[model samples]
Target: MPRSILSWSDRSLAAQFALAGGVVMVLSMLLIGRVVAARIEESVVRNSALATSQYMDSIISPLSQDIAEADTLPPGARRALDEIFTNTPLGERVASFKLWKPGGLVVEATDKTIVGRRFEVTDSLARAFAGEVRAEFQNLSDEEDRGEHALGLPLLEIYSPVREVWSGEVIGVAEFYEVATGLERDLAEATRNSWISVALVFVAIGGVLFLIVLRGSRTIDRQRAALTRQLGELEALSTRNTALRERVQQAAARASAANDRALRRIGADLHDGPAQLLSFAALRLDALRGQLAETGEIDAVERAVKDAIREVRGISKGLGHPDIEDRGPCEIVTGVAETHEARTGTKVAVICDLPEGLALSQAEKLCLYRFAQEGLNNAWRYGGGRGQEIRLDCRDGRLGLWVRDAGPGFPPEDAERHEAEDYSGIGLAGLRDRVESLGGSLTAGNRADGAGAEIGMELDLRGA
Candidate 1:
């Protein structure tokens, strides 16, 4: 389809409708004008034929046989013919006339030079000879008829058969050229009236159609505008949502880093204040036992003091992250994976693709270590630990840590079970909070290969 000048996108509905209506109106006017003009011309020719035929009969019926075929009229009859045509009121109405024989000869005419002249039989002449009257408005394109148009006036050409009054036999044909000035006026008036009527009807119909289309167009335009406005609002909302999500992730990351720092401080305080005191007490108990070998409670006191020191040391180890701030990211990730493997007996495969001397903040390194530690521990405990792999990759200013295990995967069917279990799902949630707080994301699910489960974390470290 061709594109519209007033396309739907570019123009309002009302304008489009108006343009279409205008085209239809113009086409209708042209069609109606042609029909009206054709009808008016036909009516004028038909009426002129009837009027001219009757008048010719009054003059020619009296001598139909006197001028039969090829100017065979006697001297007196010819004189009578000339007198009736030239010296009467009817003569003023007629421009010319001819009596034609069946053999295509002009039997008699007002132009005496044409008398007995043979002319080609025209369709109208042939029809008249066949006992039918024919009439037309002529431009005189015919060679024989051209001389008659020298007056520069339109003519009503009529062909009427001169019939016998008694037997109704068509004996000859009479061709009449009547002055069409008055007929032309009547036709003009009729044509003007028809055009006016058509125009009025066109206006009334087009107006009604335009009004209906305009209303619908306006409704459509309103809907489109409202939709556009709604779309704009939705786009703005989406942008804000993205910004809020980023801010939320950053806040979560900062919170996790703060929490880690607090725990590290607590661990240091416990080790320095409580663990040191326990160790000193254990040493004092050893001396007291030697001093009081007779007392039975010395061994019990020594064992209790040693046990308290051990527990304090264990608590401190659990609270602290790691002392690998000066190390590269690769060293930090590998250390966490190795440590987890040693503690859990779950052999982890570590793949490091980090660039050498990559700079990162302490919190970022801690976040990476924590993620690796949590991911490896979860894989061992929950994944059945058939096979384990840890991957650390840095590319395009983003760091990714992935831990996967070839064990029972996390499936949708096990979701409720995991949620109900304290250690199963809760640990992952804490890990997520920690990762998110550091402006990163964490995800845990079945591996793409369907053979294991995978837990991954991604952090943006462009400014690290």
Candidate 2:
């Protein structure tokens, strides 16, 4: 989650990416620098060697031609060889040059004292005497060599024979020595140029790399801040959700308590007021009947009293005056089934296989009673008072309730649209909400017989 180059010291993705890029940049620039440096060194070496070789070629032909006529005039020939080395085309082009006789005696050298002494550089002289030219390199043989002017690196030497042209007689040889100073100069210049190029390349690449690092750092910081903000928001949201759940629970409890109190008062009021008023009216009607025993008014009073008593009974049934709140959920459920059977004038069957003594919270009991009550009402209204069935059972510590009627179920589209419409009485939506509020589920569907609608609800009892 930490998105930065520094954060990637331990295999982070951002660090990995940046590291790979820097490595590639460094490698590519270094490789290019090395290739350019090598080429520059090669060119320097080639030019220096070419110039030295060309100067040697120019002096060689003239020295060989002049020396051929020398042995006959021995007096001036050695001096002539001396002049050949000192005044050659590139003055002092050969740091040291020598001429030797076929038997390896030094015929001539620029140093006059060693003209006749056997040359210490015998191998190089012998190579020339054998009629072959050879080039070589070595350290400056003296201890005084140092710095650019000194031949410290190595020497380049070319050795070749000078001979008699007409008779082919082996006479002498010439050996050229170019000390290491000359080669070192060319090499140093090449190194300097190479370093300059390296500096420029390093500067450009380093600038780009640093800029890339800067941009990447900024990006990582932004992402880190964003993630932190999101986490804070999520924590706040979770807290709010928990508080809302608690508030809902408290509201439901208060509502249930209030409903319970209202139900008891209503039950008391119906039993006291309506029952007494109807009883008083019946006694007065009996007294009037006796008083007018022989008159037609007596018959009329008898009919009016009978009508008032029947009306009161009807009002009580609709109000669910006694059965609604006077009993437990189980009794209330059983009583509704019996009332439906009697009032609908249809065959209403009830199959109650519930275990006895099932306990429920007040909220849970109210939801169960209301759901069953509305289901029966819907079945009676829609089924046109035809056959109805009700079922309730308890097993595995859970309860299941069902109500059915022998009539076509509501059209699927109409049910979906009108299910929310609650003009009066408890509709299907209210019943469903009631069931769900108590942590139970209710569903409606066509009965298995393919001719009716069935409503089912299930609830956990002890688990509720």
Candidate 3:
């Protein structure tokens, strides 16, 4: 009927340990009590048998002589037996007695009617005839033992062998029934005392162990709570790191967009302010030359003003980007390549192998345009102004731009040094930043043929 310890809901470690310890302690105590009681009973029975056998042997020698031949003992021996049995220290403790011959015949007894009766040889009687003394606490419930049963009390039955003095042969068996009230009371008390002592020892040991377990349980609980708190903190920190990374990406995109806007503004300013003013100055110089017809200084000034106007206009045109938001990938690439070819007056081979109507965001389009523009310019200035190849392709969910020129490639060491110095001139580094801000990657190296410099940019367009 006991509940299982594991079945307990939300039970603490200390409680579980106590429950298990208590169960083991109780089981151990039960086994100890059984063993102690058995040993006590054995000792008590041996002592009782030895005492009863000695007292009966001394007084029953005469009765045994006449027991087999006669139904009753001789009167003289009978009177002596009667006097000893009723009026002695042995008689006070012994409740009843019986004498048996070899064939289960009751030859003489304290109960007169049973003197001539024959009963079956019991296990105890058989053992006695075989020269053994047997003693046990018995209930006296057998039919042959009805006389003793009538006493209505517990008895210690001792079966003693009556042997011949000279031959050392067992002649008859004597059954002695002793009142067991005092013995039972003593045994019960001893058992109670033993159980109490053992239980106290077990409980004391269990108590000490439980206290140690309880203390350890408290420490474990505290550690568990602390670890849970630390785990929560780590999760929160991870979430914050993710948010911070997202914010950094957003900021980089905004910065790239700001740079493009500034370039357009600077280009507009150059064209509207500096280029217009220079053109007006060139026109006035021409007019002064017309008025001072043969002045050589006037002619040099007019030509200088005209050259300045052209240079300023070229600078403005180079800085501005064509609006290409509504255009697809091919149109955007073609526009950038053509503008570069026109301004530099160099041959640029354009190759476009993209899916029809490839959609790109406005920022992504600007990034590609800037990449192509910078790459071609670098190729012209540093790549011997030779054959240049501009390629735009979208395949396998990626958009790519590759620019190559048949010129000496940029050395890896030189590239590393430039990057460390944060080089931005000629717009190679700036182009890389704009592409990267749009979640793209750019690489510059020699072409696979090892004959020319190459700049390549790739963007993941799966999200788009």
Candidate 4:
């Protein structure tokens, strides 16, 4: 109901239960104790009244036989009542006595003023006339009880039926007040005991429930703490994994760049050293051809030298890296195709469907160039450069490149073996590594239409 109470209750499961259950237990105990005390007091008063009424009935029933026919008790009966009250031990215990005819008429009473008086018929008096005994303790509210009230002590007021001796029919009612100091003391003791027992039982139950709640609350708290610790550990591990992955990707990019630089150096070395030596040998052989008598050997030697120079130059040209850093994805791919066509004298079909202003990282650009270069070279060498097609496009934020040829595809078994082979040159396997370094993948297989073989590479632009 209040913020402070709610906050306190939320402190723990046990506290919550204690706050709510304690209130219920206390209210229940009070209600049950009050009811038990009331029942005990009522039982004690009724029993005391029954005993007093029975003893008085024994003495008065015989004297009051004339009351069955007459409205008032005769003088003789009245005198007996006076004698019993004045001279007997019963008078010491009883505070006052009265005899009533039906319809609220008091025919006789120890107090002479209330005799022959008519008062309102009370519930107890009516019950007594109907042949039942009713009793109340210390209740002096009736007009007839004014004298008893003046006595100023606890009194058990009793209304008992008087029956005709022969017929057992109720004819008159006897109402009396008995001094009940002992009963009052007994009721007080009983009420005290009842309240104590109820309180003790409720407390015990509350304590047991609290213990259960406390045990469960402790268990849950432990589990929650453990789970929190575990979650923290998992989060830390995840962060470490993310950092490691980024490091790996950076290493791969650096490696790819280093490999490209090495290839360019090797191409430069071949072109500057071996091509010059082979060209000089060819020129010297041509000069010596005229001096030889049998010119066939000289011609063969010169042709061989020329072929060696041509091959070395071609290899150097293929190995040399192109200046593609400033170009977009479409221009890079188209340039590679055009270069391949000019070198091999073969026409290449170039399909560029990339979005305008497409961008890529340096690593990705290098990977794409090498992929197209290697793919077209393979087509020329293995497939006679027939029906060569380079397809490029950007789809769903990923850049795709495909080089296809109208030649027999790789055999399934050889293709699988080739994927696992170590590639030292700028071949399919090495190209695969370069692509994968930029978070891209390369796949070599037959075209879906069965018209050619296709080598495809895809890179995620977002990751780049």
Tell me the whole-model lDDT of each prediction, alpha carbons only.
0.78, 0.63, 0.80, 0.84
Question: After superposition, which runs of candidate 1 have C-alpha atoms over 4 Å from their true positions?
Answer: 1-20, 54-84, 98-134, 160-174, 209-249, 260-376, 387-404, 410-413, 416-426, 431-450, 454-464
Kindly indicate the candidate among 2 and 4 with the higher lDDT.
4
Number of the candidate with higher TM-score, 2 or 4: 4
Pairs of residues clashing in candidate 1: 252-437, 253-437, 253-438
lDDT per residue, candidate 4, 6-87, as tens digits? 8885688787788889988888898999998898888888888888889888987898778899888888889888998886
Question: Number of backbone collisions per candidate, in order?
Answer: 3, 1, 0, 0
Per-residue error (Å), model 3, residue 62: 4.7
Best by TM-score: 1
Candidate 3: RMSD to truth:
10.8
Q: In model 4, what is the error at residue 393, expressed in angstroms? A: 23
Candidate 2's residue-wise lDDT over 1-464, tens digit each? 55674456655444565678668767876787788877776566545555665556555544555455543225555455566666665445556665666665555555556556653545645666676565554533422112212534355655665657666554666655666575667677777778777868776876687678768877887897899899999999988986776577547656654654565555456546775676687678777766764757766766776676665555444434343444655676777777666766666677778666666666666666666666777777777756687888887877888888887776766642224221124467766756665556788877767777888888766644
The weakest ten consecutive residues by lDDT in model 1 span: 416-425
lDDT, model 1, position 269: 94
Lowest summed lDDT window (length 10), candidate 4: 415-424
Segments of candidate 2 deviating more than 4 angstroms: 1-6, 9-24, 45-185, 192-196, 208-238, 260-407, 411-414, 417-425, 432-464
**Deviation (Å) of 215 in candidate 1:** 5.6
lDDT for residue 192 in candidate 2, whole number 0-100: 76
In candidate 3, stretches whose alpha carbon ends up further than 4 angstroms from where it belongs are 1-9, 65-79, 87-89, 116-120, 242-464
Using TM-score, rank the candidates from best to worst: 1, 4, 3, 2
lDDT (0-100) at residue 186 of candidate 3? 81
TM-scores vs. true structure, each candidate:
0.61, 0.43, 0.52, 0.54
